[model samples]
Target: MSSTTHNHTDASCIFCKIIAGSIPSMKLFETDKVYAFLDIGPIAPKHCLVIPKWHGAKITDIPDDYLMEIAPALKRIAIASGEENYNLLANAGTIAHQVVMHLHWHFIPKPDEKQGLGVGWPATKPEKKELQRIYDELKQKL
Candidate 1:
């Protein structure tokens, strides 16, 4: 991450630079709204990233149209990677391990347990009443 802070349109954004062709990338596939490229430092073989052309620091900041285009492009890139075992991941903020301020998706090929994303669930069993109450609250909002 550079000293530049997150913004909707930033001149110092690396992903934006890639989208503008000001910086070189191992281009995989591109549409008018999205760009997919091989990650320079990959977690696994054929690891790649997909980003929207419009500058948005988080996924929620992206326009619905750009978000829609990104999903299919990532699917195509994942399928073309020639690895069935893979992980499709995205992070929204620094706390979520998002180093880049630009909104992007990671298509990481997980060949085995030793590679790709290593996840752990620090889960706790909540009381049934609590679960039901939470579900009801969300459902009511919906």
Candidate 2:
């Protein structure tokens, strides 16, 4: 871990305040690199927010190391939430409904469409050739 990742807190950020023990939150889990807690305004029953301890405004700004470190904690929270199925969502920007500027991942235990995390994907059934072409293009870029 870099020195930049150590105990840094933003006074203006709510998540920072929560991490710094300034604001009260229903903490679910905590580690040196990450924090997990219940969302104050939950869309579902087991709605939890997992965030990096570092004050990252968006996914692009957060270190990849911290991002990788949060996976195990997320899995644990999902399993403990007691829902067989769940959705892991991270909105990057304002257009994506990221109300809080901190880099947080939402773990919503989805029992049904009506209850927990409701998703409306504008999916299209593309031709096999089109799919292959798109995949090939992405693979080349990668």
Candidates' C-alpha lDDT? 0.85, 0.85
Error of 2 at 80 (Å): 1.1
Clashing pairs in 2: none
Instruction: Put down candidate 1 lDDT per residue, 1-142, tens digits, no spaces.
Output: 1212334456898998887778999999787788899999998889999998878889778889889988799889877878988889999899989998999999999999998988888999999999999999999999
In order of appearance, the predictions have TM-scores of 0.89, 0.83
Q: What lDDT would candidate 1 get against the real structure?
A: 0.85
| Root-mean-square deviation (CA) per prediction | 4.7, 2.7
lDDT of 2 by residue, 1-142 (tens): 4323575667799998888777899998787788899998888887999999888778778878788877898899977888898889999889988888999999987787787777789999999999999999999999
Model 2 per-residue lDDT at 12: 94
Off by over 4 Å in 2: 1-8, 125-137
Candidate 1, which segments miss by more than 4 Å at Cα?
1-8
